[model samples]
Target: MTISPPLHLFEAFGVELEYMIVDAETLDVLPISDRLLHSEDDLPVSEVEHGDMAWSNELTHHVIEIKTNGPHPTLAPLATRFRNQIRQINSQLLSHNALLLPTAMHPWMNPERELHLWPYDYSPVYTAFHRVFNCNGHGWANLQSMHLNFPFADDEEFGKLHAAIRLILPLLPAIAASSPWCDGQKTGYLDSRLNSYVPNSRKVPSVTGDVIPEQAYTQEEYHRKILEPMYREIEPFDPDGLLQHEFLNARGVIARFDRNAIEIRLIDVQESPLSDIAIASLVTATLQRLVNESCTSISQQKEMEVASLRTILDQTIQDGERSVITDRNYLRQFGISEPQVTAQEVWCKLFEDSRKQISASHPDAIPSIELILKEGPLARRMLNALSEAPSIEELRTLFRSLAECLAEGRAFHGL
Candidate 1:
């Protein structure tokens, strides 16, 4: 395999979206990702490339990931490409009465009973994680997310980009929370995927670290402060060193030194590619403005404490747009003069500030962003489609519509 050259800040982007394969009629988890990977041939391959897009397997057999084949100069065309791939995958899955469903978590999956690890290719690594962390839970087996990765040139670029990412991390879930239900009921937290993700590696606290990354701007500082401690802590459980790489550090946003980029793992996969790409566009544009120091100086951004950010993150994970931001200091970072505001207000300001950049780079995303701002995230829209105590069939009905949204590349706007 050949490696691509490193990308400079904002030069390009790589987005990865994970979806669950489920029984078409019942919406139950179907462990058939390998079947999807091998749909074109008889061999059980782990990944299949299709020009600029590719389909790959995740840790769980019930999940499949679709990603850009490599970094692209812009995010404008990926939704259509990803939608085409989803259509093909759905067509193939028709034979098995299974199709791809989008969301950060399955509404009714009992992970303990239904979890199936991918038993091919990198089974050893999965097995190691299962052995150490017990992958048969909601965190490991029943979570899906959209990973937004952007490259940085060097120390100076990395510092600016990382600082911008840290400031925006808490607000991501407010706009992108899609995992509203788990175990056949509302989990109370809007983004249950992230709420569970924060504690997935509780055995090794250094691995997650409050779900907000430390203020380590440079590579040397990141290695010494974040990476080194995590590697040392997980070394005992992973004695053979299978899980000792940069990937092991599961902070919400992680520095991928190998790729010279940072990947934000906090956004839940939305109901459709359109919504996902729109959220990505908004995030990228906002970060662009911040990196250029349009809103605040790098010094002020770097001064944001982890505890304060984590507190906001926790609130958004639970309440999403409705979560109030009472910290005047945090509000000032984004140029908001209000003493306190809802998470949605902060996002409105960001969208207004970054409208020009979004229009220039991803004009297609404007409508979807407007829809989210007006209606709220997918999780809230889903709740609007059902009663407070919806029945199992009601849940199924709502999610089936979400699956259709994925298939048709249309955003979900309640029933």
Candidate 2:
């Protein structure tokens, strides 16, 4: 299944959004994804196709993933088609008293009891994961994310794209943190999904290089530094050699040289598909300007040290937009001069510059940019709404509001 290439930089991209199936009334995670897939009347649940949209199963039975067929030139049509699929899926699940919720983690569901693997098609790979790493852990069984795939047609494009992604990977959590609660309690980290995800894969140390990727200037370098280490580490465990490909990189941002693309895996799933598309547009447009204009280089002075970058990521995951950017050296790279700045300030400047560059061609994304600037990211909004829910009944009330906004395709304001 080869996807078509994009004509210009940032002009085209693909999206994949993961969502959880939960009971309509109690809102508990429901492992009925397989049953729901076949429950639809007109189509085969294994792989449903509607024009460019594709629906499929994931590692767990409570989760499903929806992806666009190929690179979309515009997000308007993409969001419309995606929302239509969500509506259709929700309608089908209603017969079984369940619905899909857009979130990185279920607020109160216990993954230990609810975790279920897809029994058909590629079950061997999933079985390996379950046996090797105990996939029932919080990182594997309970998290969801939004994946963006951007094309890099050649070696030059891959080099430039890889550099740009590494520079901005740490700050993504500040703008997309949606997992605030886990196991019926506050996890303290705003993007708890990522915090858990990093350590969860550490059992297989070669699989991930933590949140930010190590610098790789060429495909050969990436293959040697990132891919080879992982393959070597897993070879001893899987004598059959199941996990031998580039998919093992597992870094926050990875280069798929085979597909000639770079996949960004840092962003959490937002409340609605529109917001998710909006964030994708913002990131794509920003990277376009950075690479085309040569605004910055991957030099020593311009880059943050690996240690400092990891520390910042940890702080942002805990504090979200409120995290302070106190490193004046790093702040200068983004053109921030304040003695101290918040994560919101960094995103505000990026969005403003990106809007100017993208507005003439793709104006539909402006509202989403403005919404984040004004209302804060989805994570901040969720935290504020959760504050108002003082009791279990009130929490349910707030969640219902959020689920409704997700289903209705609207921005979620505080309850």
Candidate 3:
């Protein structure tokens, strides 16, 4: 690694948002990157290879996620910069007349559509996978994901911080808001495309090994204990870390670092810039609180139950807000005086942290996350949009509106 990875606290916040390009008139799928990569005038290429912010890959049209090197503690400033940067990049690609869209799922785009692979390591993994699992969902088609990198103070404050991060893992599916219609009907799961990966991770052994016996990890320890094991089992060129290319999408590189931070893997792309920053701040607060605290009172016996933590993580995505036997000690870790614990209570602590962080770091911004919790996951916004207009057009419009609202100034008052 000639270029040493960026320093912590400075780790650029990364967001992976997916949306399919489509004909405005026909609502048909469009491959803008495909159009550009083989277009008339040559676009400047990234010699660093897969490092470019945008490219035509086996996956659907991906808007290369550029890390924010600027201070991004607030939604207004962050969304403004992110929107401008993305638009500028999209415009360059549009020299070929290709349009860019930010959506969880393209209404008419078929995940079953046959498309070539992106130039990513996971291609081979997913390629072998389709033979077994029917590829109705394009594992690659313009995926909708919200990737957030929460900055950490250092590696020493690990253990429960990392575990707290994972404890909330089940909430993802409930909040998931893309790729609704699969196999010609609503799969009833917002992120069925992303969820496809969950079933296959069963056989793979994670570094932390399912949180039964919590292990503290330093930066080097985490990489060795967690990352290195997967890397060793997986073939060298496979970036998605496919343990075996037979059954899983293996998707892309989703990693978590020790120190003052943890990286999140689930979430679709934001329809607009507002969704991006709003979701980012919401997630960041939980991660920060988890850093210097104990999350759940999950005992070794309870954690080692017949189902196991991994099993819980698997089921929780769709079920949302899963709770096992949690007690008083865990609540006290985060300064919660309440002697009992529930999924919603823990969530309240997380939301409270967001309020504090916003008040201190970003006083003017209203917490968009508050809305997500009160109303529902971003999925509700998408569902309502689709339901009201009751057409594919209406669904996409609602999706975009909810996304833009993440940054609306009206929502940004003294929150």
Candidate 4:
């Protein structure tokens, strides 16, 4: 159930990071998550929970999800707890000769052949999607992301939070596009995983609605506009009606009215927990800036109408920081005074301003933002590394190095 609404605006935060379990040396995706999680007789308990940190299964057996207990007021402790949980999972993974990989998409896993749906408590929920959507595409099978949830107290708060989030949603890929390669080859799009996610729901359009989420304000209106259609569409397949909830509706951002919060699903997982928290901090700060300024009116958001926002988002996903920001009005809305600005400039300005809103000084300034400004997003960095590698074998070696960066809680410096 949704916790009582936050007492203050932007009072708490929660994060979920998804990772791929793979063979340590060969880096092949491992579908042994069930064995790690359920083999109590042969191994220790797979699910571990300590306070706000916990481990759980995902739609695919090769993937697992880690999340905090509830929204946190500070990011440093949250990041610390998240890192400790990763170490705990890695320790257990040693017995299985597997470990979690940091990248958003596994380099060479064919989801159709390798996909293993979680068949425990929510088996039918996954089963329905598998049967209908053929849940084996890169989107369903390989894509991993960082999901950030922020709590709201009431309808007014939800309205403000929703608007602020929608305004910033389009720009997220510019800072967090880490999935550049799929199927062991460079997918031309920087965030190729999103290509699958945004379009994969064509079979269940009622659920995802273009993957960029339409404008939603209150719980009743959101249910009518988004959730009701999904419930109706999935009812024939899901007789038990478990898929009727807001979470399973599959939009880029979901409003958990029961939980009094909105969960943003568009961000890609970053290189390290620190980077992830930095991005989270930037998001919170940017949203808070909008709320503090009281820019909750729908009229103020006209500059970022869905059509223009979608264009910008798609361009960022395709081009990374190099994507040109042509919407002068949209840029101006974000306080980009310059007429000619790139996507990175808008993000940099947000990062600079939003850092002030955060309580802790851990991420005084997001290194990823600076790095993207200097080089590009993680996808571009991966692309540069691919170009430099003398051979395919060398590229594989580089990915192995990238894995090391994730394990150590360090950012990948482009070679």
Q: Please report the candidate that would top TM-score against the real structure.
A: 1
Displacement of the residue 322 alpha carbon in candidate 4, Å: 0.9
Candidate 4 residues 1-415, lDDT tens each? 8754355566778899999889988878888777656543655344646677777788887888888876777666666677777787888899988888886787677887888887676677788778778887887888999999988888888877887888888888888889887777777788887867887878777777766667777878788878887888878877776666766767778898877878999989877776788778777778877776543344576335677788888988887777888887777667666777778878777766765555355553356556666787788888887673235576568778877777777778775
Q: Return model 4's CA RMSD, one decimal.
A: 2.7
Residue 72 error, candidate 3, Å: 6.5
The sequence of per-residue lDDT tens digits that candidate 1 reaches over residues 198-313 is 88999999999988999999999999999999999999899899999998889999999988989999999998899999999999988988888886899899999999999999
Query: What is the C-alpha RMSD, rounded to one decimal, of candidate 3?
Result: 6.5
Residue-level lDDT of model 2, residues 302-344, one tens digit each, is 2556566777788888888888988776666566678888888
Scored by lDDT, model 4 comes in at: 0.77
Model 4 — which ten-residue stretch has the worst lDDT?
A: 294-303
Winner of 3 and 4 under TM-score: 4
CA lDDT scores, all candidates in order: 0.92, 0.78, 0.47, 0.77
**Quick one: ranking by TM-score, best first?**
1, 2, 4, 3
Question: What is the Cα-based TM-score of model 2?
Answer: 0.93
The residue-level lDDT of candidate 3 at 150 comes to 53
Clash list (residue pairs), candidate 4? 2-259, 52-69
What's the residue-level lDDT of 393 in candidate 2? 60
Write down the worst ten-residue block by lDDT for model 2.
293-302
N/CA/C clash count, model 2: 0
> Candidate 1 — number of clashing residue pairs?
0
